[model samples]
Target: MAAKDDLGRVGEQRAAAYLSDRGYDVLDRNWRCPAGEVDIVASRAGLLCVVEVKTRTSLRFGHPFEALDDRKVRRLWHLAHAWIDAHPGRAVHSRVRLEAIGIIGPDPRSGMLEHLVDLR
Candidate 1:
């Protein structure tokens, strides 16, 4: 369990860096409310991006993205709104958008990172 958690943390860190490099201002990370947790929340060019990151040590079961099912996506949406509610005025001039990231490798530090923007 610890190893899995460590990998997730590293993956999220990598995702955050990638976003920052692309000019996204990170607002929140691992934010949780009654609905669920949001992996990363950022703002870029008047768009508030809610990012969900999935990390896998291997593809033995499936690709990292395979873990994000419909239910998970729905939960992320709920969490995104909850985040907006929590941080007033942050979304006033920004549109909400969903983003996803998948990291795959034996070690998260050297993982292959793939990012998808504006997921419906």
Candidate 2:
């Protein structure tokens, strides 16, 4: 696989670990539907969080969280609803949330990870 792909995988792993550490129960990874892809689907405080993982070498280009635009948010919202509806247990008292996971690098030496909750 390409180096960028490897970096993305590593970044996703890091994001998962980070979310788990924060008491979020990960229900799925790479959840998909007709709308689009949701990088991580987790629950915290009885709310379902749809996360978008954005990885980059640095902030030179732009903030990683900035990559999730309005269109992406709309897609994620649709997917989140679909996910909740698919799981009857969760649908009763569930709420949808949007988040962004930003990874700074795969450098290992100085890599940084950021999780922005409720982005949308």
Candidate 3:
């Protein structure tokens, strides 16, 4: 894989581990369709979370979360619904939420991880 792709995979793995540590049950990773892709799908406390993970090696470009703009957010929302539709057996009680996990630096093991919940 390309360096950037590998970095993103590492970041996603880190994000999954972080969520797991926090008591969230990770259901899926890299869930995709014609609409778009969701980095992670998890459930916790009756909330269905659709996660978008952004990873960067440095701040020279910008914070990883900066990539999730209005357009991207809309796409994520659609993707979340698509995921739900595809997985009818999954039960969601509270509601579906958009989340973002940002990783900065190459080593996700020690890199800075910022998780932003309920993105608009």
lDDT of 1 by residue, 3-102 (tens): 8899999999999999999999998899988787899999988888999999998889898777778888888888888898898977664488999999
Candidate 3: C-alpha lDDT:
0.89
Per-residue lDDT tens digits for candidate 2, residues 1-120, read 998877777777778888999998888888777767778888888787888888899888898878788988887888888888777775554467899988886462248877787786
TM-score of 1: 0.94
Ranking by TM-score: 3, 1, 2
Q: Give candidate 1 regions above 4 Å deviation.
A: none
Pairs of residues clashing in candidate 3: none
lDDT of 3 by residue, 48-85 (tens): 99999988888999998789899999999899889998
Q: Give each model's whole-structure lDDT.
A: 0.88, 0.80, 0.89
Q: Considering every candidate listed, which one attains the maximal TM-score?
A: 3
RMSD of 1: 1.2
Ranking by lDDT: 3, 1, 2
- In model 1, how large is the Cα lDDT of residue 20? 99
**Number of the top-ranking candidate, with lDDT as the measure:** 3
